[model samples]
Target: MSDVIVVGAGLAGLCCARELADHGLDVLVLERGDAPGGRLRTDEVNGFLLDRGFQVLLTAYPEARRALDYERLGLRPFYAGALVRHHGGFARVADPLRHPLGAARNLRAGPGSLVDKLRVARLRRRLSRASLNEVLEAPQVSMAEALRLEGFSREIVDGFFRPYLGGIFLDPALETSSRLFAYVFKLFAQGEAALPAAGMQAIPRQLAESLPKGAVRLAATVEAVDRGGVTLAGGERLEAGAVVVATDGPEAARLTGAVETPAARATTCMYFSAERSPLGEPILVLDGEGRGPVNDLCVPSDVAPSYAPPGAALISATILGIPPLDDDGLEAVVLEQLRRWFGAQVDGWRRLAVYRIPFALPAQPPAVLALPQRPVRLRDGLFVCGDHRDTASIQGAMVSGRRAAAALRGSDSGPSCAL
Candidate 1:
């Protein structure tokens, strides 16, 4: 029997287990998957490292800053803005403060009126001054409503925010909470959006490695959870002083007998190999026309050379929802779309992989966004934590994990880092 059992070796479970083990508690982490990363997984196909779905880490996360070593991760940064394809042409948009002289020029020539650009700057300044919790706990509304109320014209909402923010939030309709929108906006303002040079899976591996030897047990599936302990799939039951259900929302509900967990947002990402990159800049390319399945595109090798072998380039395209077309048909459609923007060089791009995640993120609408997020200490010895319990982000997963560990030790203070 262990002092504490963490059922899942994802970022949440690893963080919580590390917290407990550091306090001299015997922590055992069980994972059904062979690897520790849940959705943050990466695989080598031929010579390319492809993440499960397209994802980026924000350096501004308070929990990440507190718990992780950035230098060790070898963080790689993307450009401050994007190249948006609109009206059969590509236009650039960058934050004026970040790019200084050039962003204003792009804003003047891109989509959205001068008034819309001014309102965006004003909103950025207002949110940057607020505390992290203040922004999170603020009253929530739909992103579409927030943009409209902020005095941005519909043209800006559709051409800019819909495709740009929608790619980040995984909601093309902008139905996510304004609170999350503002929080992400502030993060973008404060720090760079980056990826670990090794791949996204490197994050979970680093977190799990900090624990004592034998702390993590892979291929161990928890069939059920009770007050006593968890029952493994092979029929053996391991008792513990406490059990932290750190699985995703659906699996957590299944183990703990909880009902009505939130639904997940879906996403599809396709990886491609090319002779040469269509765009050389490291900025994300957005489909401002919104006339096709492609939402946003990027080349990992453009940002970090390690993602692909020395000579080849790797490109990734993200689609927010599952469409009716099959994988082959979808690729055909996307290739035709790219041909228009980057000329016929796109015809040579080879399909490397396609990843469709139906449960990419927990849905964070207005009500869920407004709910006070804290670790669920089911009882004195029972607890649960995941991105579902917090803000539905990498930060939320690690933060919830740390909070669950604190609850086990009867401490209310989770992380000391302040944003």
Candidate 2:
């Protein structure tokens, strides 16, 4: 019998198990999927690595820095700032603070006014310097309200914040808590947005590799989890010293029968293989108009050439709403829009995949933000953790897992549990 049983082999479950195992505890991780990485999985198609969605890791995340080995991931970084598409041209908004530039040129031509850029920089500085507790517990408000309170003009809000940050949080209205905005804003400001050369799955694979031999058991569907232990799909109960439910919010609720899962954010990601590169750099392309089906676009191969086969480019477009058409129909619609942005050259791009994720992230409002995120400690030996329990980012997921391990350590002293 294992000392600890963790349900879900995603980053949270994997990280929690790693922590427990590191402390000399026998940890058993059960995952329903054939492989790990609940939402962060990757697929290989025709020699191209396609992530489940457009996801990137910010190196500034404390948990990520402490838990992950970035060097081994062969990190590929995107160009600083953004490539905002407004009317018929692209606007560049490089980090003036980090990458020194011709201030006059960028101020007059970037997404927002000079004052707006300065305000963004100031907030970014504060986020990078502030303590986690101080930021999370700071007075809260809607992200929109917070931006207005900071005196951001309508131009900057619409051009940069609306499409850019809106796409990130899946909240175009900016109804998310100001604290979340602050946390994300800090990440972007302080660190480069990047992906592993191998794919997002590499992160989880590394975590699982750190565990003991046969520590993780995939294809083990968990029906429920309680103080006693976890029950498999066939009503097989695997009793253990403690149990941790680290699945997504909805699945967690189903297994525990106690959590009221919050509303979730949805998105549609479409991938296309182009004959040639559209944009030169791996910069994020956003629709400032706020009406097109494309919320944001990126050519992953521009930064990490390995994402696509030689001489080909991979274009990923993320839409805020699900497209109401079949794969062929949706592909046609996406290509039509791409032609507008890149001209007639887009005619040669081939559609690769269309992933519409309904539960991309948890809808975190002020109330959800105020809740204490941790082991949750359902009873004496049961607990829960995931990005849903905290912020909806790789950082949050890993941090919540660490919190669960801490709770497990505190609840009982280290020792082997009798079978």
Candidate 3:
């Protein structure tokens, strides 16, 4: 029997196991997949790396900075701002601080007016002055309402904020909590949005590698969990002194019967192979027109050349929610939109793969963000941790994991909740 049995070798589970093992506890991690990364898995196809979905690592995430080695990951940053498709053409909206000259040149040419640009700067300054906790603790409201209350013009709200923040929150309506919006905005202002040289999966893989050998067991599906231990799907039982449920929200709810299953946010990502880079720069392109299907597009090879073969470029298109179309139908519409953006050159891009993730993230609405950190200790000898228990980001997952470890060690003085 082990001191702790952590279910789901995702970011949360790996970090929890790492923390426990650091304190001399014998930790056992059980994962149902063939590998350690849960949703962060990457599949190599024809010398190209395709993540489970299009994802980016915010370099300023506090938990990630503590848990990951950015230098080892060989991080690559996207351009400070996005090229927005607006007014029947594309316009550049740059970060005023990062690209002062560009920001000045395009202040009158982009989606938002000069006043909107100033407002963005003002908002950035206001958020930067407040701490993360202060921002998260501020009054709760929908992102849409927050934008409106900030005195932003309707043009900027629809053209700039909708597509930009929509791609991040996966909420086209901007109904995500303003607390999350402010926190994300602050992060973006503070650091870069980047991808690892190997892929997003490198994140969890790094965490898992830091643990003791034989600590994690893949392909071990835990069908049931009690205070004593877990029973695998193959009818084998593994006993432990304590159990930590670190799976996604729904799975954690199913196994522990104590977690409240938060609603899921979905997304679809499509990859295309092209002979040459379209944008010729490592930058994000957003559909400021509020177009459907393709919300944002980027060339991964531009950001990190290793993402594709030497002679080719890897393009990723992100659709906020799962489209109801079959693969063929979806590809057709997506390409059609691309054709409009990049002209007839889109016809040369070959479809690589399509990933539809129904549970890309746990939905975080106003009510859900009410308590930034949920109680991780469910009962005596039982605990839970995942993005669902926190802010629904990589930072949330890691923080929740560490919190679970602290509670298990009896070092957490925070109030505990009953199962």
Going through the candidates in the order shown, the clash numbers are 0, 0, 0
Worst 10 residues of 1 by lDDT: 410-419
Residue 402, model 3: lDDT of: 88
User: For model 3, where is the 10-residue window of minimal lDDT?
Assistant: 410-419
- The order of the candidates by TM-score, greatest first, is 3, 1, 2
Model 2 pairs in collision:
none
Per-candidate alpha-carbon RMSD to the true structure:
1.4, 3.7, 2.3
Task: Supply the global lDDT for candidate 3.
Answer: 0.91
TM-score of each: 0.97, 0.95, 0.98
Put the candidates in lDDT order, highest first: 3, 1, 2
Model 3 CA deviation exceeding 4 Å by range: 413-419
Off by over 4 Å in 1: 415-419
Distance (Å) between predicted and true CA of 406, model 3?
0.4
Error of 2 at 208 (Å): 0.6
lDDT of 1 by residue, 298-412 (tens): 9988887788888889999999888777889989988988888888888889999989899999888897766748446887688998889888899989988998898888986
